[model samples]
Target chain A: MSTDDVDAWVESARRGDRTAFTKLFRAHRSLITAVVFRMLGPTGDLEDVVQEVFIQIHKSLPDFRGQAKFTTWAHRVAVNVVLMHRRRARSRPVLVEEEAGGHEPDAGLLPDQDLSRQRRVRAFYRLLDKLSDKKRAVFVLHELEGMAPADIATEVDCPVLTVRTRLFYARRELAQMMHDEPALAGLLAELELAAEGQEQAADADEPARTALGQGRDRRSDP
Target chain B: MTERESHDNIELRPSSEFSARAVRHVVAEVVAAPPPELDWARLETRLLERLESERVTLRSTPPGSLGALFGFVAMAASVVLFVLGAGGPAATRAAATDQLVDVATLPVIDDALGAHSHLAASLAPGSALESGGAARRFVLPGVAAFMLAPGSRVVVRRTGEPYVLELAFGQVTAEVVPRHDTDAIVEAFIVESGGTRVAVHGTVFSVARSPERVEVEVTEGVVAVGPAGYRGDTTGHLLAAPSRATFAARDARLIEVYAPTRATMAAAATPRRDPASLLPAANPLGISRLAEPDAEREVHVRAASRQAPSAPGRDVRAEAVPQPLQGNPGTDATSPPAAGGEPSAAGAVAMSVADARAAMVSCLRRATANAPAASLSVSVSSQITVTLDGDDDVATVQFAPPLRPEIQGQCAGLLFGRAVAGAGSSFVIPFSSR
Candidate 1:
């Protein structure tokens, strides 16, 4: 939605128009829900967190200076709420199921391709579980979300160097884990070979080379 | 062979598709999982209910209001009459005293008055009553009754032929029956608090008295509220039901009218509940479902593309084309320069790109010093665009992708303080971690 539309709805909602507020809720519910779900993972309190985000948005609307897009501001609020939930959860005991233990292959089937795929998927999440919340968020945004280190820095409110460092560590750790596991070793080698081929191909493509050079310049250390 | 053919010829291992398959799996399992069904209408109703409750909680009541003091006093006088032998047993007291209005049993009163379940409360012309920290209810048979809020003191007085109540503090809700007496003379019921008086014929209203003002809220009938002697004329305001009038003690000339909301009345009538206990519990298994691919998800897929060696140069266009900058919502085309001064040419700013970077490094180092290292990741390179005024003082520093407020504040403090050579120029300083 345009800024003007948001501003109008906000003004109306503040004046006690429930319909206008509902409109605002409808407009941004998806984005807020997605962020909350991603940050908390599938296990935590997704619905409560989303509701809390809206409640907070209503309370904080008066102070909103329109400094950022409504979605961006809402996204930040969701992130903060999730972080707080994480902190509170740490002080309390939580019952979490093992990531890989839940799914059993069909009873009569042999160890087939689908089972192998499911195993790999489970292993991926296991690796993700090893990182701290901050590193995990950074990795998810960069590697999974395809956000640049710079954009991830802005979203997570950290320095670009920090984002890069987390990404570097996350990738290194995942690679090590994959290599250590016999089932994942062959897949890891195959990915590594593809990566090598891609890098080599980048050297041959003129535009790719220029883009790579620019990427390097922008990525230079302070 | 064509490029596509050669690419197709390259042996595709099971693991070659591992990352793609894993991405799809995670997306399907978590990101794309369906959210629990929510009834928006029900949620909205609950939210509105809570908001109404909060509004009533925040509604301002006149301080030192007569409601509190009068209620207490009325209750106290009842106790005093019962203790003294002015009235016999509680049952007989109702018929004995001509001056006594009525006697009724109180279901709930302050713990102090717990022993006296039967309240033989009656106010004579000269009698005064005080209630402390407990609500008192009095039913005047065939005439009028009132519920006195806690901490009230009230004295009954005869101003001419009218029955006038002098409320010193706190609040009271009185329901007076209209005068239908066929007798020769009829007297008006007047509630006097602060410098204001509310005259009622037959109505249900609440009067609150504070040191600063007297407020009257009419719930069921009409009331004339104004300075004590202003006879229902230009000086007095006629208040209908569901309306309120406030008379300031400082300036008798000012009277404020208010329309009380239905929620406010309902809340006042209903007992207050602890707010925290009402919050709904979180649903642990309800992950949000994705209906369609979002911008962020697309970014995720594109990032995955770069990792696949088999898709070398498949579409480098996605990475090469910079996403359009999401401008600061606060900034506009007509916005003033960042330095809060006249816009200056970029060349006019004296600070070199290097100087700004150094400043940013210093600021960021300080800001992140106490923060956990793991929490300090910035995925994208941050571009801090500093605009300097004519005097070379930093006018404004805008972060391309906004950083946390603390970090932004730190950067602003460091860069704006220094005098640059070309004061008006804008310098884009990029901070990259790697």
Candidate 2:
């Protein structure tokens, strides 16, 4: 885990030492899998992406430079591999259940309805689905992952201004979804409550609060 | 009571804030270590063999420079054939002719129209008839749809439009848009496995059969699949939506729909055996036994949870899970092996989860294998509930026809799988059925 040990492993891995390469793969398998899963969706082929990432890491390791952190470089490599792999995936857009025409029928509701909180979150994602793929990436990285805008700009190869603009718009869109979709707004509130609960449990994890506090700084950019 | 009211509540709420938590969970899972003992030895051997054979060329010492000149002349002769698109004169024409045939076959489905019934035919727009099963690739491009009885397998070139497949008992993979849109053309693509009939609408999908399960995946648009009604449950459920995937158990239950990410896709080359969440909820329509007449039993019937309550009149009995086969045996529940005996908890869970997983895996594998032209249709008879162990999230769907089962199930699986594929064990628990 030390920097020195990490440096040696990188050098060894670049030389095609299977053992060294295996060590590196072991260290990052889960991280790579998570990234790939987020980029794709949770469902089928988690293992496929994991194996592919290792294979790609092996194939592309020779180009690694010490300029960036090993994790950063690996992420860069992983991003490309995921995007390419995504292309190879059948370009099918999973559809939502088509709404049946006419007034919403009053079907039976579950007797124990604890779904008040859950339904809202579902609507939020349904709205998030409307954002363009690029905007979505920016939003997910900056807001969800809490990656600094600069880091996102670097990863996505765009200007920081563009990242900021995307974030601004993304928030606006999310906010608008709140206004336009009452169900979504309630869900957002529930989400905030859930997040607050988690925060009270682990004060360390609520980066969103800090991110929110920095709203002034973001606004000052314009 | 109304979607509008649902919207009203959502508007008053805060934004969904599990992003960071979800991401962190994903990070922890992704960064975990691989198991100590994998078939590394075999993988290494394979890699070495490939390197030795492909990277290292055999070098021979010619008898002086004169022999070298002769070698160059022989090399030129070989080069001419390759450069001319063939290794030899006959090979060149054959290759060209095959290309021509493939090109002529441009759209695979058009030819399938009016083709003889019960007879498997090539649908590839322009591919040549090489020989044997290789020729089966052509069947995908031509047919609009076809029917299959138990024990049938068909291969077709990838296409676009969904083809209807009737599965009495067997497996078939149709081509989707493979590297090109023109690759998919055909209409009726049918594979009937265990009385379930799946029709490909406008998506690229595939289906595989085992004795107990039938797997389906939508590589492109969503595919609609339902039970062909061989026995136990006649109603079929939509497996997956566009880009989503699902598997169908022979008991005729549709398992979770999963969306493959880049990583999982890369990791899995063959059908996966990982345990999956349960299928879509069973349809409550026309239940022979129920506690109430309008119990909305369809919604609960397909519920994935073991605790999912059963219909009123139908006696809900707890049964043990069935013993898992050595690996996944794609069995549809209704094909001959009647449910006369009691299943152990281990057996029931294994069967439920395995069958569901197989349906999804088979769907995906077949899509990659066969891209058929024509629109795929999906109709579900009930609601579906997906619950994950160790995770608070449970995806529940109570909606109408053309259900996007793939997306629903995939999201549920991914959400849970991301957090629990390794350390935390999970299974799709089916409720006790009468």
Q: What C-alpha root-mean-square deviation, in Å, does candidate 2 show against the real structure?
A: 24.9
DockQ, model 1, C-alpha based: 0.03
Alpha carbon lDDT at B53, candidate 2: 26
Query: Tens digit of lDDT per residue, candidate 1, span B116-221?
Result: 2223234556444445566555534334344444555444654333445554344444444344343111334445533344444233344543445455544333
lDDT per residue for candidate 2 within B205-278, as digits (tens), equals 44433333444533333344543322111123333222222333422344554333222222222232211110
**Residue ranges of candidate 2 with Cα displaced over 4 Å:** A37-41, A83-90, A93-126, A178-184, A187-222, B1-434
lDDT of 1 by residue, A1-222 (tens): 787888889888877787888889888876776676556554435555576678668867887777787777777777766665554333121223423211232434356854554455555666677667778788666544445667778877899878777766665566555655554665556666887899888768978879989999999956
The parts of candidate 1 lying over 4 Å away from their true place are A1-4, A96-126, A144-158, A177-222, B1-434
DockQ of each: 0.03, 0.03
Interface residue Cα RMSD of candidate 1 after superposition: 19.0
How does candidate 1 score on lDDT? 0.45
